[model samples]
Target chain A: MARWEPNARERLVRAAIDLFAEQGYDATTVTGIAERAGLTKTTFFRHFPDKREVLFAGQELHSRTLAEAVAAAPAQATPLEAVAAALDALAATFTEDRRDFAARLLAVIAANDELRERAAFKHDQLAAAIAGALRERGTPGPAAGLAAELGVRAFDDAFARWSDPSVARTLTDLAREALDELRAALAALG
Target chain B: MARWEPNARERLVRAAIDLFAEQGYDATTVTGIAERAGLTKTTFFRHFPDKREVLFAGQELHSRTLAEAVAAAPAQATPLEAVAAALDALAATFTEDRRDFAARLLAVIAANDELRERAAFKHDQLAAAIAGALRERGTPGPAAGLAAELGVRAFDDAFARWSDPSVARTLTDLAREALDELRAALAALG
Candidate 1:
């Protein structure tokens, strides 16, 4: 069904980012975004429920990928190991191709308090999804929740590192390094 | 100044919570809350900037408590220990007298996605405050951020436990237990 719409989703997302960057998020509207994309408002609605959704459409994909990766980890892997695996898989999706878009999107979000709140909620949602996956893999209670949160923090640090223009490292490499730093930090706490 | 205002803030908060719980957050208005509290709209505005503020008036106090506790920790304490001290001090403020209010507030926030987003924002604010305090004490990035986040998670879990009707533990005790569990969990990550 989505194939029939060609690149409507991508076009809408790009149009949103461009308009948001040009005029600020508060000044942008769904209708204006659709027009910028050379698409109808109806077509825009089919892809996203709201203007904000355009900036966050990839969340479901990211969450699904994370959960699936955790679930597919080796049976003997510890909770933290499974979480690290899940984060590595998710980091791979943030390939170099998306770096420019991510940087711009983060700038727009950083400028708006509402968007920052939405980002926090999105992070919590991913943590919860990852925790659910860990629980399914037999990790219990606070362990699963703690490991899930640590994974998200590592992803955040790695993504920020990867987004830096001066950093030539891949997102996967950055993520692994970030996880190692966090694990060492945790061990130091002991 | 606040003493002259008597319990006007408390009255307004109680009225807002009762009205919100009865008629829902969206349906409850400032005017209705003021009327219920035997106060004028002007008085209500003087106490709270908005309806939502009535439910979250303690945030500033909580943030201050956390930052102060972190700052007051022994200079020799590790980043994680400083964070634990902050959580402990903040938790001590949540005496059994506030349990019912905390439970109701959590219920209201949970029922409304907008409120929940605001709650997440509040959590982020506290985390930032803790991180700032930790940095002030010479802790560096990633270490301060991660420790602050772990502290917030411990407070959250402990608060939930303390709010449980079947649980008779003091918030301070619950917090200690929660932080201990988190520390063990983090160590097990190794």
Candidate 2:
């Protein structure tokens, strides 16, 4: 059934985000989202457990992407270097076509406390994934955790910029620059 | 009326933790918790908004403690130093008497998904409060955020250790040691 529906998952995500932005997240119902998507409530449930999850659909995939990238980094690579590789890999997934949607999604999340909390949970989960991967490569516990944090922070900072209309640089470039800036900021902490 | 029910808040918290631990978080109810506390449901409502909030009663106070300590640091203090001071101040509130309750609270949270998510949200909120204070003290954005994260992480790590019966060190000592270890780990990231 899903195969016959074409891009059912993508369509549901777009429709949900559109409705959330239009009517506000709190007021938008899953049934209305399904109706707007030209799909059924059953289909919506099939793709997402609930409306809140539609906005964070990429969490599991993004976590896997990061972990795999870290695991694939050269054995001799430093913790931060491995983290940098993971960030580049993850950033490549956010193509120009998704920029507007990403921007709107950020706004919708910012306006809702539940969504913001879910976003923070997703952020920590991604960091955990990256940290776990680094640890598997024999990076020490605290270093792995700190490096993973930097990677996620870099991506998050870059993502905000990438979502903006005026930011012309690629997500990859922005993430790299953000990571470099954070590394330098370490000195300023002292 | 409130003045007559001395330590009602503390009694409610203790009862809630004991109930949550014995019956499991999901199996517990506000009415049951209130009954265990020798308080009315109305009194329970006066203390907490919901059953889940009972386990996280200190969130607001903890955030204010971290922020105030950061704000009160000397003008010459560095970002990390300010964050360290905040951690020490926050850790001081968790006296030896609360160790058993703290340990039980952690176990209950770890066993429940909703509780874990709320814990993570509280962690980020604490970091944000500390970061805001650091920025007020003229710290740079990235550095402030990073320092605050380290402070929170240190406190979290130290808290787990402090909760252990075998760990004789004070929360302040454990938190300070954890922060120093993280600072050292920063060098290992590269």
Candidate 3:
């Protein structure tokens, strides 16, 4: 049980994710998550602004890590390449055991209209962050923007492939393969 | 006023879009749309299930068209290609004249979380419709799903490009171009 000693925050996430998976997102409540976590509702609030916020911990972290990776990239690297590398770095945080939870979270988001909108917003934010980082590194207007969006799409392709139950490769390996596939696909257009 | 004749449906849509674009989605009332359309408020309820339904008149039609297109495609066609052609058929309806209303409607949806959720739900429905169509056309399981998702991503890319005031082409043209781009990128990966 040492590995399972969840803090209040982790407990809330686990409870929320589990209850959400078992029943449904709409049926899950802050009260339920808190009670499952052995904490009061106030504790849940302290850790997250709303029930929705608790469900998005991994997403927020991914965004931060992705942004940092893009920002730290070398000068003169193309925006798409930089963003692709950043995405790979983010994927390294995932492990084989985490794939099930991640996949469930993704499916849950995909299954719900409200969560899908949040996911889209986060995708936009991730692209914007990458574009901003690119501009700072000297990439220009729509080029940076388009590259960022494309990078995001490639990362998405990588994520979907990686999260599949039958796919046994590491997330980074899948990301590289996805990036290569993306490059080939885009180049074919030209 | 021939162009603005009392097509009650059109009038309602125009009024609703106007109110939504101007006052923000949540704050605007169905009564406001009715009043603006010069009809009784009760008539608004007659035309729309709720205020929210006013913004999305032809989403179902669009999905059906896409499904039919996908179903009718050649069995040998690649999954992504088939879905792109289907979506292209759907894109044909958005002429340059509709750009303003479309952009405004998008902006309104973007500003409101609830409206955004509804939009995502609608998009997912379209994706499912396309996936089912692919299955009917003899495309395999997860490949069909991935193709449907890729098609959605292509449509999204084309949408962002066409919706930009700086973009100089129709959605179909942009979509075709993006599809080519996708093909090239994927080929490069291979």
Candidate 4:
């Protein structure tokens, strides 16, 4: 159990994922998760409002990381560059240690429509936060929003590549590649 | 009611929007919409599966308009131009006659979380259709996806502007302005 000795929140999350993967999300109850983690239902409730919340607990942190990175970009950086830099910063957070966990979480989300909706909502929230950060840097409407969305799309593409088991590239590398492709694609559009 | 002497689907849609605006989406029922349209609940069911489907009835038509337009673009047209052409085709369908109805529909969607989710889902569906059409034209992944998304964003911004009561511009004109702004913003990324 030494490998499993973590905080209650982490323990509960691990147990929930395992149960969800084993018995399906709908069939896995909070009590089942708690019992598997050798904890109480009350502890599970303390950590997450519900089973679905566990899958999205990092949303706020993820949004802050991207927005703060965009906000902190050099004053001379163009809006697109600032957004690209923000994507790089966020990508760096998805280290080798997270690949397996991300795969599991993504698979769980893929298997559930309710979870997919929540994921889409979280993606929108993150994009809006990035757009707000761009606006703070004096980028105007539609422009800021469009640039932020492009950046998010790059991050999303990179995350998918990095989460693949056979892929050895870092998230930052994949994201930069995806951003370049996006730029080239836009350039080709003209 | 001669002004509303249209098909049952349109009547049901009009009834649903009016009821949603007056009593909120949660309080509006299929029976309420049918009664408001002076039609039977059976007619409403034949046109839409439920109350929620009324708000999203146009998604398939919107997606087809975009994809078909993209597919028919001149071979020499840039990916962006192809997408721009698609937007113009779609904008032409949203005549001045739709401005008031569109505004009321948007307001009802804005006032309801479920409706907003459905809208986002519809927007994504439309973007994917555009990307597929771009791919059929030999544009690659990530690039096709990004360009398609940018075009959709332009349409979205333009739609908002077009729907405003005080705005006098045509949807095509607003979309052109928004698309130009997007191009300039993308170019500034370098």
Task: Please give, for residues A1-190, the per-residue lDDT of candidate 3 as tens digits.
Answer: 3334457777888888888888899998999988888788888887888878776676667777887888888776666778777878888888788788778888788778668767766666677787787778877644565567666766776778777889878888877776666555444332
Report every candidate's CA lDDT. Answer: 0.87, 0.92, 0.75, 0.86
Model 4 over residues B16-111: C-alpha lDDT tens digits?
999999998899999999999998888888789899989889889999999999999999888899999999999999879889988989899888
Which has the better lDDT: candidate 1, or candidate 4? 1
Tens digit per residue, CA lDDT, model 2, A1-190: 7666788899999999999989999899999999999999999999899899999999999999999999999999988899999999999998899999989999999998778878888999999999999999998899899989999999999999999989889999999999999888875654
lDDT of 1 by residue, A73-108 (tens): 999999888988998899877768889887888899
Query: Each model's TM-score?
Result: 0.94, 0.96, 0.70, 0.88
On the 0 to 100 scale, the lDDT of residue B151 in model 2 is 96
Give one digit per residue, the lDDT tens place, for model 2 in B1-190.
9977789999999999999999999999999999999999999999999999998899899999999999999999988899989998999898799999889999999998677778888899999999999999998899899999999999999999998999999999999999999998885553
Q: In candidate 2, which residue pairs get closer than 3 Å at backbone N, Cα or C atoms, i.e. clash? A: none
Model 1 steric clash total: 0
Best by DockQ: 1
What shift in Å separates residue B159 of candidate 3 from its native position after superposition?
7.4
Q: Mind giving the per-residue lDDT tens digits that candidate 1 earns over B108-148?
A: 99999878878888888899999999999998776788788
Off by over 4 Å in 2: none
| DockQ for the candidates, in order | 0.69, 0.67, 0.17, 0.44
> Lowest-lDDT window of 10 residues in candidate 3 chain A?
A181-190
Question: Best by lDDT, which number?
Answer: 2
Off by over 4 Å in 4: A1-6, A26-49, B1-6
